[model samples]
Target: MTVWQDDVARDLVRNVGDRLALLTRGEGSHVWDGDDKRHLDFLAGIAVNSLGHAHPVFVEAIAKQAATLAHVSNYFATPPQLALAARLKRLAGAGIDGRVYFSNSGAEANEAAFKLARLHGIGRNGVAARPRILALENGFHGRTIGSLALTAKKAMREPFEPMPAGVEHIPATIEALEAAIDDRVAAIVVEPIQGEAGVVELPEGYLAAARSLTLKHGALLIVDEIQTGAGRTGAWFGFNHEGITPDAITLAKGIGGGFPIGALVTFGVASSLFTPGSHGSTFGGNPLGTAVANAVLAEIEDAGLVENAARRGAQLREVIERIESPLITGVRGRGLLIGIVLSSPIANAVVAAAQERGLIVNAANPETIRIAPALTIGDAEIAEFETLFTAALADVQASLAASETEKATAP
Candidate 1:
């Protein structure tokens, strides 16, 4: 007899940890493991399942598209692709004057946008100076080489050094960003709320200041809305709340309602940045992906999910704040994207406790437990998680107290 670990499939990859094998079958605002145990999902597939699991509308759209037409090369255009592009422009308020390039993920979207920035930096008529991109510390763009170069996380960068040069990092601030912009810089890439960095919101006036500075420096402002777009942040795009129009915006995550799709949106001068042959993705505008994205956008509008996110986010924050656990230092994040800061670095412990109690959450950092629940989660679901989460924090506190008591009694 052979154990599960003895299987050839598990042997293919070097054993990193016993963690990755955890399998989940179905999820809603929650999910069930292969064991059929239910768990409240606060991560929302890291903010991908905007409509949650098994949404009938998305399923229907994907099924219909896959059956009729799933893919096509760049040489041909499909109706779903055209429709999604138009809808995204309307949602981003890019107007009919804008253009879009589709891709398969946020990183790919950013990669396409980055290349467009470089092209724009070089100018249309003459050879221009190589353009540099100014990204912020703790900012996350994507995993691709170019996007990774714009990303500021050292752990993700050190492994892939000598990344496309000309990318720079500055503190997430208007003044610091202003200081970083040189004549050779082409664009400043920013996330309205830094999701992976513990849901850090940009300082007030930061976007406005960036717009002014970029205008002064003749650079484009590229807002990476990968985690905050498509009603995730209670707005179509995070920049909408800031009242600033960026030169280019990259979007993914919930845009496809769990389908793999990403897009680069541009307006005015930025629209002309890329020529026909400058950039392309084979699977970028596939019928299946775009059709699902189109349905996702329509569902969001018809159901007013963005407004729901705003109202429910406040309610969730209030409920968590009422917990008032000494273990909980504070709660930060906007809309459905939330972060609970703990007094210690035992966030992973809290996450484990929550998971054991049928709740799924993520640790954004050692001390910050992040929750990005589905935008459509009901009031009852939020309350249930609040109770489970508060209790989990108590468990962490009790464990800490017991450990401290053991230390004191030992001496």
Candidate 2:
């Protein structure tokens, strides 16, 4: 007799040790557990499901591509790869006569950008010592060696050190930028909004300062848009909202809709930096993935999903603010990448409560709840979220109050 596969997976796999639910089905902004309980899916597979769960168009696109041509080696070119590259270039905007290096995850995208900065240094001053890369204090890149080095969360990185060196952190301040960035730097990488740091927005003038200072010191500016790209932030890219284009931008998460794909898009002088022998990825831009990505892009444009993201995001935020839940102190995000700040350090408890109430949400930090729903979610779904979320908050707060009373009366 064979044990169930789900039980085997739990015992065998090495993971981060936090498993919320075993989701078996998804449609629109909702998912179901193995027990057949339903959940409103605000997490959206950590911002990967662009069109929501099991959209007919997205399903057909994947199925058609898989039937036709699923994958091929990187040495060959596919029509979807070529077309997706062109689409990304055009959407990246006017000044960048750019090129793309596709990969399988956000970390790989940053790895490509990391190497680009080093190769750039070698090209500039043969066997050079300009070996510095600067990232932000709370920024989250990825789990790979190179990207982990760039990520600022020390606890995630301490076990892996001595990591790929020559990387440093800059405080999120204009003064820190003014002081730390100098000629010795090779490249400076940042997230336009630090997603892992509770969806924290970069203070005003910080990105513009990075752009200007990198220009002054001949350092490359690399932007990580992994969690914020592909209409997740309402605009085509977060940098577009901030009005600063970096030398290169890293992408993933929403680019392939629900599939796994990542890309490093470089602009102007940085476009041709990665020549032959500089980089490669076997599963990158495979036929099926790129075809799905192309379909996602078309759906975003043709259906005005980007505009929908803007409008719905505005509506969600407005309603949440108006609720004025005592537990909630403030709400912040652009487009659909929202973070709800709690009045206390109870985000993890809130996550559990929210799930119990049939809503899916996440704790970006101890005091912040993250919401990255599908771009295709409509008014009906948003209303459901508002109702469920309010119940969850009230439940948690009441539990906390009861706990305090019990403690007060305890001998």
Off by over 4 Å in 2: 1-10, 94-96, 123-125
lDDT of 1 by residue, 272-298 (tens): 877778888888898899999999889
How accurate locally is residue 268 in candidate 1, as Cα lDDT from 0 to 100? 78
Q: Per-prediction RMSD in angstroms?
A: 2.1, 2.0
The residue-by-residue lDDT of candidate 2 on 4-84, one tens digit each, is 455756586755654677788988888999779999999898889998988887898899999999989988999999999
| TM-score, every prediction | 0.95, 0.96
State residue 182's C-alpha deviation in candidate 2, in Å.
1.1
lDDT of each: 0.87, 0.89
**Model 2 worst lDDT run, 10 consecutive residues:** 1-10
Clashes of 2: 0
Alpha-carbon shift of residue 172 in model 1 (angstroms): 1.1
Give me candidate 2's TM-score against the actual structure.
0.96
Error of 2 at 287 (Å): 0.7
Task: Look at candidate 2 and give me any clashing residue pairs.
Answer: none
